[model samples]
Target: MEDAAMEDGETNKDSEVAPALIAVHPTQNSVAVAVGSDLRVFDLLGGCAVSLVNDSDGSLHKDSIRAIRYGANGKLSVSAGDDKLVKIWSTKSWRCISSVEVIESLLTLLAVKR
Candidate 1:
């Protein structure tokens, strides 16, 4: 099957190519991209890359990330993947706050203001 990265305009020309899973911050001009096993954040306007969270210390996901989104407050971000788990992360500390499992593949995540 074709990878989602290819659909996102990324090409795999190398042996070590990794799929890209990206999420844009709600209020900031920044974006988060999960390439291979690493999560990278970049500035949209400055064109400079920013590093938000690195799960290199341990495995971030059992498989590739399928979706990511900014929370309602813009202080948190959410990620869901083939692992069948949804992770909540803090924007300030870049730390995982919670993880919840769900049935079937997680297709999307939407943040609602309360």
Candidate 2:
């Protein structure tokens, strides 16, 4: 079965902060988790935090990541945050492709294939 972050308390902050959001790739064996200002990709079966979120500079969201979703055959991922930013990332390279600044604070985001 497909899954996402099945393990509990994998991160010390798991208890300190509740998961803001969770998104399982529609066709992939991975899960995206949002905690505080950080976003982590986890192995569905292994249930371990992966490095898909890591970057040479730093985190993707400046504030808490409030929403996450997969688009178009799980090839694209989107994240929105309290920082008032919406970001799109490519699942292939895990690199950011574009970003949009929202005038109003963002609560959630849903990306659909066109």
Candidate 3:
């Protein structure tokens, strides 16, 4: 049955890809978008793309980013997704300051902090 499903190009729920997500800065100066494993930002003031700096050795998110949020004060941003990693960013510098792996058991705690 599994082989037949594969041959028919049927995809399981777990294998389904997520839709792109968009987040606007609190001050409405910029907007960030997550498409697949790529992250893009646009400057509302300049009417151009904002180049982001990732100090890490690899891409921001290894998998699709499911959520992107900005702090109420417009000073910080967060991104998390299927890669099982959460990242904190500095909105001023547009740089990633920290990243942590997500543990299934601690998911509740993380959500509560958000």
Candidate 4:
């Protein structure tokens, strides 16, 4: 498989590199798109990019994000991928509330534990 990143630590510039995953809020008020190791979110109501609090090393995901989902009536967002990390985000604050590291390959289906 081809790596998404380029030599400059940025994603590939190919126009054909489509989003790896997309998640829409239950209420249709927001959308999240995962491309390579980056995650882009938009607020439908404001018609602007949603500001997400990055608590990590200035990167969204260390590896390509394979799965993204919104649950709990769009209050929570979950993202996981080759990094073997499952991250839960609070939609309200757009901040990562928790993260779990797994030893095995990531599972696309994730359920938010209240």
lDDT per residue (tens digit) for residues 37-75 in model 1: 466677889999754553543556675577777876679
Which ten contiguous residues of candidate 2 have the minimum total lDDT?
Answer: 1-10
Clash count of each predicted structure = 0, 0, 0, 0
Per-residue C-alpha lDDT of model 2 across residues 1-114, encoded as one tens digit per residue: 223355543554445543578888888789888878888888878978776643434668887787888896888889888788888888887877788788876566565775
Top model number, TM-score: 3
- Give the candidate order by descending TM-score: 3, 4, 2, 1
Ranking by lDDT: 4, 3, 2, 1
Clashing pairs in 2: none
Report every candidate's CA lDDT.
0.69, 0.76, 0.77, 0.78
What is candidate 4's lDDT per residue for 1-114, written digit by digit as tens?
Answer: 145345434433433243478788887678998888788899888999988786865566787777888886888899887788888888889998887888867566666655
What is the lDDT for 74 in model 3?
77
RMSD of each: 7.9, 11.6, 3.5, 6.7
Model 1 Cα RMSD, 1 decimal: 7.9
What's each prediction's TM-score? 0.61, 0.71, 0.80, 0.74
- Between prediction 2 and prediction 4, the one with superior TM-score is 4
Q: Give the worst 10-residue stretch by lDDT in candidate 1.
A: 9-18
- lDDT head-to-head 3 vs 4, winner: 4
